[model samples]
Target: MKTIAILVFTAFLMISCTSKSNKIIAQKDYDKYMEIKDNKSKDFAQNEINFWQAKYDKAPNQTSYLSQLASNYSKLFENTGDVKYLYKVEALLLQVNKEYKYTAVGPIRSLGRNYISQHRFREALVLANKALAIGEGMKETQKLLFDVNMELGNYAEAEKNLKYLTNKTDFDYLIRVSKWNDHLGDLKTAITFMEKAKEIAVINDNKSLKIWTFSNLGDLNGHDGNIQKSYDYYLKTLAIEPNNSYALKGIAWIAFSNEKDTKEATRIIDNISKRHHTPDFYLLKAQIAEYENNQALKSKNLSEYFNMLNTINYGAMYNKYNTLIYADDKNTAAKALEIAKIEIDHRPTPDSYDLLAWSYYNLGDSKKALEIEQKYVVGKSFEPKLNYHLATIYKANNMMAKVAPIKKELLKSTFELGPTLEKKITNL
Candidate 1:
């Protein structure tokens, strides 16, 4: 009964759900769209507009149906990054504002989302507030309001709404709480909630929720400086659903930061940029080029990067690498080392230490690497790659006595202890 009431209220809030005839149409379009909605798939989400439209055409008096159609179309624009589609959304949103402004929740939240997309947080907040003022039953309006307030840096208001929604105690509410913590720099809290979302996805057998949680986990790992952990999470997400451009971006970032493999990094980012043209894609490409001896590519990538002003990590890596390259000349490298050290002072986690140690090592000093590797090798020794590097480094400089311990670790590591490999390890 409570479930029924909630669903009814949610439908009231969204302004519509489905009639049998429309449900048939929506189901059909969804099936067709899914075929094309690859990870890079935007058209599927767009075609949903058509499904909703077909429903509205069958029952034009159903303002709720039209409202949903407009929202669907608006989201297609958001998902695809097509301004023309958003221009379509702009008109559709206006239509909802006109025909059903009295009770249409769809256009309200849709407009807020579109405004946010345009970086018009002020406008977005207004629309979101208007939606909240109107009596709607679902938490989505609250969620959008929370997000808009957060975007405007109204963290207190955002926290109030977020707490309300979080207390709903449903799977959707849990996911929302995770995302809220994610943006607030509380990554550990984000992961804690996201893990609950992951469990909910598994219990409900919901692919969308699974993909979202995995990607959120990936983002959280990246924030914590677990670059490889971030990469692996993204890959897990991709294994479930490819064409996830964001995950693909994570791949480029992880490769660059963790492996420092420019070749592989460039290839991955370049392919994604060909399709997406996101600012992050170009910035990563520039970073990879910066590492190369090729001046032409470096210049091109830097030009692309500079054209993007609001990038995170802008100038940080470039400054670090430049200093590392010319550490002695103007003592630029020494200056850069100091900068890295200052950053580490603020966040002395494994990654900060690892980066600091590597910068020092690149300055022809391995002493720092030796110091930080102890922190980095934290139970990760079961992996073939790092253990090998650490063990070899230990073998060098007459530290071979440490080899036995590492070999023992390598043998005990997860990768080496598979059921099939157990006999082999035993024989060895």
Candidate 2:
């Protein structure tokens, strides 16, 4: 009888731990955020854009009005994930730069940032170099160069640029440093730096900075397995910007990946899509459908996503996603390879290399994939998806010894990889 009691208590403890581990999301904490509300922030941005646009129309030579229009358009893009707004901003900035004959560092830097958003890293790098040569706004241009260099996998140059902007207390410097540490896989240090940046944002009471810091900390915390903290940070972001799709997506991810509450996740995502209408949201919905074994729903969502991509020429912004999707299908594997090479040409980042390697692997050229992985991806990137591809490629090459440690690491990253990949990782 005593032995039976011990077994019962142990079983209860195991179940309790399992429940605690799974119960990371609380509806009450994020339910208010999920409620649709009047998007005053977006309205204000549009009003600002209209005001500036009217002023620019009245005095076409007023470059300041053009800049204001571009800035407001960027804010609108943030509030609503409308790619047209980004293109509008890009066109406005290009006009401004052309008017200035590409001699103005301010417009050049702004255009560089716009290109970065479009994933045109090489063009951004060119703009950065032009701004650097202009010898105005040297510090800001250096920051832009650092960002472009990092995106282009010019790590040595990125480090050099970072060293030039070495102000530990500066918000921009701290955030970039945090990113660098994260790229190096020192997530704890990354969080520490980001927390410092968050303190600066709170001290300044800068709404935009606060939103950026809180949302980024939410992502970093999620990556670190601090799901509860991640959810709270995302809520904080929503408190500041009620229409922040990114924060809402983070909460949806917590519901789907950590709690396995696909229905609730779908609810949040569907709500966001009603407002934002971004392509990636459809991809995420497809992933959830795949997880739930709803093949028809998955196919529908994927078809919708591709249709949207075709309808809207997003330029190279969706290349990575397109590459991954194409690589997964036998018929489209060659198309994936073509897109992957284009991505590499645009930005030879380890992540891009991983896409190319994955394309090769999908085409049954595992040896070629192994070569690329060894040369570019093995330790150059630490993204969970990249690591998963590396492990799979290693296994394909019969490198079981290399696959074991990565599989162990990836088991802890199921939440980041999402529910669909959880079983795939387990099989690995």
lDDT of each: 0.54, 0.83
The number of the candidate with the highest lDDT is: 2
> Which one wins on TM-score?
2
For candidate 2, which ten residues in a row score worst on lDDT?
8-17
lDDT of 2 by residue, 1-428 (tens): 01101111111001100112557677787677666678988999989988888898899989989999989898787667777988999999999988989988988998888888888889889999999998987878878888888888999999999998857699888988998998898989999999999999999999988988887888788778777788789899989988877778887877777788999989998898888787888888888999999999999999999999899878998888889999999899999999999999999999999999999999999999999999999878878889999999999999999999998888888777776787998898
lDDT for model 1, please. Answer: 0.54
Candidate 1 lDDT for residue 378? 40
TM-scores of the candidates are 0.58, 0.94
Off by over 4 Å in 1: 1-43, 50-68, 71-79, 166-168, 179-185, 293-295, 302-428
Model 1 residue 320 lDDT score: 32
- Candidates in order: C-alpha RMSD to true structure: 14.7, 9.0
Residue 417, candidate 1: Cα error in Å is 35
